[model samples]
Target: MNIGVIGYSGDKNLEPVKSLKNICFEIGKLIAENGDTLLTGGRDGIMDFVCESAYKNNANVVGILPWDEEGNKYLNTTIKTGLDFSMRSFVLLKSVDIVISVGGQVGTALEILGAYAYKKPIILMRGTGGWTDTVTKTLIEDKYLDNRKMVELYQAYNIEELSQHINNLRGDVNL
Candidate 1:
């Protein structure tokens, strides 16, 4: 299985949360141990860290760049596959049986939305920025992630719990 890891890039003045990066690495390791490939944005911050960790553990890494070759010069050479973002999201989510949203910005949130729209299994790492906190919590408070449609919405505070949830998911018609 390929688990798509999503998070914000710590570029220039922006910075990703420390706890988020740690969780991403831990989750990356678990994906490796399970012999599953990992997919990410293919740059620095969460993407670089997650892909590097997974690579160290001998897991295949796929990088979906938000831009073309011009935008990927900063991307790590560790990626096994680097593709354009517009075409990549569909391919990335389809290739993965599940998706884990780490620390993110609007971009990561879009990935989550795509995964959900496709009926793919999704795990949101709580406490990260973007839709991770705002959207789901509101939905949970308003009673959205608790019904039959929620068979695909999963949330975890840490990497271990996320992996456990992935291992336990079953009977879903998609992903």
Candidate 2:
């Protein structure tokens, strides 16, 4: 399974929100342990955390880069889209079977919308704040977006629940 993780790029200092970073790292570790691939925007913040953790665990990591820039060192396969962020975002969303939204701003909102449009299953890690928190509060009710009942949206408050959700989807009966 190719799981895409979307979130903020943060500042140049890469001062991360400790809790969110830890959750992302744990998610990455779980993904790797489950023998799944990790996809990201190929930038910083939550994306960096997940990709790095996955790489450390010897999992395949793909990065859909926005431009022809140097890709993240942890990426196993880096696709230089040569397109702007918006276009690159589409590629990232299209390449993943599932999306995990940690904490994000406007860009993360766009990725979530893209996942909805693509009919991809999404797991919103609640308590991560930013658009994820907002979406969990209002946009999604009963695991479906308003007027879009076909969309699959799951909420995971922690790493264990997130792993269970993904494992269940993968038909891991033991889960």
Candidate 3:
């Protein structure tokens, strides 16, 4: 499966959280070990950490860029989408089976909303800060995004929970 990870890009003078970085590494490793491909925005911050770790573990890391520029070295394939940031995000989400948000600001929130609109499953890593915690703890009715329940939203407070969620999805089950 192609799992998409969206989070703080650290491009707006915001610093990357220490714990979130560790979570990104572990998440990448887990995805690779599960024989899944990792997809990201193809830039720095969370994207770099996850892609590097996944690539080191012999996973196929695909980076979707907002521009026609080169991506990080760890990516096995770099897709220069030529679209702007917001447009690139929709493309990324549409191409993935599942979406995971680490710590996010405006950009990540947009991706999550897009995923919901696309009816793609979403897993939010809680306690990492930003929208991951906000969206998981609030704005969700039970595990649904809205009255329509566009898609089931999941929260993973730790790596174990994240792994279990992935496993359940692997079996074509919804949590």
Candidate 4:
């Protein structure tokens, strides 16, 4: 499966950087260990952090870049769309089977909406700050993003929960 992880791609000196890094790292490692392909916006912040972790753990890391600029070195494959940020986001989400949102601002929110519009399952990691922490509040019944019910949004407070969600989505039912 191809899993896309999106979040902040700005200043890395924020107060939550350390915690976010740890969370992103675990997410990356989990994706690698599960032998799933890892996809991202292919910029900095959450994207770079998670890609690096997954790369080191032997996962197939792909970065969907907005333009001709190079992606993080950790990416094994890079797709340059030559499109602007917003346009590139849709391309990225459209290629993924599922998406995981960490903490992010407008860009992350846009990606989340794109995933929803594509009807791809989204796993928002809570407490990582930014949209990951606030998007749920805006959801209808904390599940559906809106009246469309395009897709049901799922939340993961920790790595374990994230793993479970991925497993469930893959239909790896233990029962």
Best by TM-score: 4
- Per-residue lDDT over 16-102 for candidate 4, one digit per residue giving the tens place of the 0 to 100 score: 555588888999999999999999988888898899899999999999999797988999999999998889999988888889999
TM-score of 1: 0.78
Q: Candidate 3: what lDDT? A: 0.86
Instruction: For each candidate in turn, give its C-alpha RMSD to the true structure in angstroms.
Output: 3.9, 2.8, 2.5, 2.7
> TM-score rank, highest first?
4, 3, 2, 1
Per-residue C-alpha lDDT of model 3 across residues 5-43, encoded as one tens digit per residue:
999886422465544677888999999999999999988
The candidate maximizing lDDT is 4
Better model by lDDT, 1 or 2? Answer: 2
Q: Write the per-residue lDDT of candidate 2 for residues 7-87, one digit (tens) a residue.
A: 877642454455567787798899899899899988777777888899999999999998796666889999999998888
Name the runs in model 2 displaced over 4 angstroms: 12-19, 172-175
Better of 1 and 4 by lDDT: 4
Model 3 residue runs over 4 Å out of place are 11-14, 173-175
C-alpha lDDT values of all predictions = 0.68, 0.83, 0.86, 0.88
Looking at model 1, the pairs that clash are: none
Q: TM-scores of the models, in the given order? A: 0.78, 0.91, 0.93, 0.94
Q: What's the lDDT for residue 76 in model 3?
A: 96
The candidate, 1 or 2, that scores higher on TM-score is 2
